[model samples]
Target: MRFSKSLIILALGVSLAACSDSDNNDVEVKPPVVVTPTSYEFTVTITNLTAAQPFSPVALIAHTEGMLWQIGNSASEALERMAEGGDNSQLLTVDFATHAQSAESPLPPGEQLTLTLTTEQLESLKISLATMLVNTNDAFTGLNAIDVSSLAVNESLSRHSHAYDAGTETNSEAHGTIPGPADSGEGFNESRDDINSVAMHPGVVSQDDGLRSSVLTSQHKFDNPVAQIIITRTQ
Candidate 1:
């Protein structure tokens, strides 16, 4: 009986040791996890809300940092080209840009154009747009360096754009200096003859107003919020 009891104790001790070893072996030590890159798609729509003015080809830019134009500062030479001639090559090449697109055709009055851009990262997401008021000299309507990182997927934001002066040329509205279908005159000159600082447009005082030499008419006049912009995230 004594030998049997000793044998039973030994068996119990071995079983307990095996169970402890199995429990220790079964414990899991997971590895650290890694996150991958996430991509996003952005859609921008611009509408010409003017009565008669036809905007030039629209320029859209997605950048990480830096502004295309400022309200109280002098307009960049690139902005001058876009505001004066409806050209956007230089503006697209602005530093820190991630993606860019331009409308193939001008947006006429009450017309809208939609553009899409994609990015992998959301940090420093910025959007800019510009279009010439084809009926005026050195006049443009758009925004510069609008932060869009806060926008969520499938969500959208809207803004009413205000007109701005390039401050590089005088608003003479003369027969030969104004561009667009209204005049088809000179586009851009290196001269800075007007107020060198950018400001809100004083609006076109067309011949119907007080500027008798103005080639523009009442149809060329516009007020604030000349354009409507909507941005949506698809991805």
Candidate 2:
């Protein structure tokens, strides 16, 4: 059949448009665009450097910018609980912290714990860690609100930590005062009989050192550095 000139032109136009659309579809579509949110990750390694003192479960927090605990200031109820009973439940409730974690068990002398924490909060990164010496009245050790925004991937900050007396309780080392395996004594007495401030821990005076009725022993004594902390950014 003979077609009109207008009909022929219209058919040609339609064929060309279909061919153009097919060509466009055949052109490689850049693979579906994918958008991923930025994430920050850190690896924390803690090593117990004491002789016989067992460290409570490490309480770790990755926060925006705030001190969890301060030297010369009274400790929070959370810290006092962990420092006394080796409990970490309360300390993990760091509302200002973007992320926080604790090891399952106590860290013994000469042992280490490595934990990785991640957060989407990429700015003003800081880390705080704490643990109790289960052998003392209220002795604890670890870093507090350390600035880590300057750390590069795979870069690390290492420090040897000194013991800190939480000062929430007196260092009696008596029959019912210590809470470690060495004593199995009671923990977390509400009455505050201590200096009520944080300070450098004085080494323990065991029964061997003339603290009569003391539950600790010579081996439980530790020097300045009680633990080591190494922090690194992985991703």
As for candidate 1, its clashing pairs are none
Which residue pairs clash in candidate 2?
none
Residue 211 of model 1 has an lDDT of: 95
Model 2: lDDT of residue 100 = 91
**lDDT to native, each model:** 0.88, 0.88
The RMSD of every model to the true structure, in order and in angstroms, is 12.6, 12.6
Model 2 per-residue lDDT at 228? 90
What TM-score do all the candidates reach, one by one?
0.84, 0.84
Clashes of 2: 0
